[model samples]
Target: MASMVWTRYAAIGDSFTEGIGDLHPDGTPRGWADRAAEALSTRAEGFGYANLAVRGKLLDQILDVQLPAALALKPDLVSVSGGGNDLLRPGTDVDVLAARMDEGVARLRAAGADVVLFTGVDPAGSAVIRRTRGRVALFNELLRATAVRHGAHIVDQWSMDVLRDWRCWSIDRLHMSPEGHRRVALAMLESLGVQDAGDWREPELAPLPALSRGARLLFDARWARGYLAPWIGRRLRGRSSGDLVTAKRPGLSPVGK
Candidate 1:
């Protein structure tokens, strides 16, 4: 993408945009979106940013709730990243979800904002495994088409080999590690044609030692018990991690203040 100018930027979505995996010293999220805003602030005279993302929200919920708030700010930008949460549910349809996302993008464009969209990453090595990967692929493709139709810039995570490295993911394996989030920030800055954007292409590290089948099973069991079970229980109870949780950054203001 060519160099762009956006002084008032707003982010909207779920945990990924909410900076769940990357944390500040005070235990608050400082994800890629925040990093990107920091870089952009250097270029604009009076840049301001807002992040309206909450954890565990569906795409429709993000669009319906967060979109209005973001538009109300009259942002020069609306970074869209969501839909992974909806795909996790058993019966969600990719086409329908894409259509819903398209509507949101259209609205953002209509509001005269530069729309930046993010694709979902590969879901390998998760409990859902192969099936989830295919669903994610389909959804990513649809998101690409949606971006094209709405003239939005896209950050394609599914095809990013940099993310395939295990070190890029957090302990939960669902969110990006701190280093990973930094890499994503660099990529975003470069995507927006920000000059002197630092390198995101880190060399892959040496692989970890292989685990025995028994040890692997033990890890899997622990993961299921610690993460998977609680997530399932929340869904069963119709509860969400974001229930009553609000965006860490709710309005456009100077980056540091």
Candidate 2:
């Protein structure tokens, strides 16, 4: 009987890797990387995994922090999802993002990670909040080229889910919802030649509705509920809430008042 080769996997990237937008039942961010790790563990033989993703990270930051830390683990499979912050930041040129990605891939390869997976940038649809679609396309192209040069597998999520259907995005238009992340995780597994369990179901995302005043308000409120409310609650509880004085007069206070 032939023995199966089980590979240990490690994930490195930015907020997407850290599960920034999608929240777990416990209110923790359940990014696609964690989902991918879970899927791989359940299906792949002899798989060990580690997720080393931080929030608010750009390509340079990932190259500096995550690359070194993940390389230390010497994983057989490595997945990187970044560059969104780079695209959003000022003075972020294509060449810079490309260089950082190349360096990241080289370092991972040197660290004995035989299988590398790179996620492309998601589509920027008609959402008023997101950057121009052209920039996203450029980043995806650069990432694809870099991954191919390094012999790494490319997860064309930008094309697969985001562009294929605008519904794959959250109301904020920047991040993926839990359902979107699930689809992305499955795509990553498929790219890596890993099969999913029988229980995995594809999420049916609704179309992106036209932006209306009421819808915008509701969406903004939901965003606050998911992202900001927890942080505000934590700060309020830890500090002296009494010190935070409320304005007696509404119009005389800040804009929100």
Candidate 3:
């Protein structure tokens, strides 16, 4: 009888994979990649994790740096998240972004990676950057086609609206909170067909607690003034925070002293 071969995984992307705001105790990448790595380590015992995610990286930047590193790993499973930065730039040519992604995917496939999972940009409605929705959708479509062409898998990160709900986002309204990252990691585990270890906790939905009318109004105003307005202004200025949103200060009232 032949023994089963396990896949060695490598993750490549930008802040999302590096876990920008979700810092580790040492302030390193604590995003979905780390969580997925931990889960896979426990599940597969010997699966390798090579996470190469830079902060504020564009698609071209990833192709230039991280792609080569991932190829060198000769990973059996490669997970990628990108394209958000390309959407941030004004007058970005979608065709160019698509071509770069296609080229990167081709290189990874040629490197003998059997399973490649590409993540889509989260929906803009749940994100601080409002202008990116259209571009994100387009990039996701391109990524899906590219993955299919390369015989890889697709992890629809954008379609997980359950995680996009306000409860899952951090104070910045951009990056995923710890809970959100956990959900995203679980989804990746499912997509990779990796079973969870004893430590893996399943995500659950709970009913929203009733709030006083004044509390609701305060929350709504804060989200609008703090998140939405700044998001719009940044986009108009042709700037992007790139998964890094300044968290709201604690112990401050809406009308601060």
- Among the numbered candidates, top lDDT falls to 1
| Whole-model Cα lDDT of every candidate shown, in order | 0.86, 0.63, 0.68
Candidate 1 — which residues are off by over 4 angstroms?
Answer: none
Model 1: colliding residue pairs = none
**Of models 1 and 2, which has the larger TM-score?**
1
Query: Model 2: clashing residue pairs?
Result: 19-31
Q: What is the lDDT of residue 211 in candidate 2?
A: 82
Two-way lDDT contest, 2 vs 3, winner: 3
Compute the lDDT for candidate 3: 0.68
lDDT of 2 by residue, 1-257 (tens): 32223356667776667666688777767767667767666555556766666665567766787677667666777777778766754567877777778888877877767555554545444433355456767877887788778788787765564435645556555567776677777777666666433222354546666789898688778877875565457555753222342211111111111
Q: RMSD (Cα, Å) of candidate 3?
A: 8.8
> Could you arrange the candidates by lDDT from highest to lowest?
1, 3, 2
lDDT of model number 2: 0.63
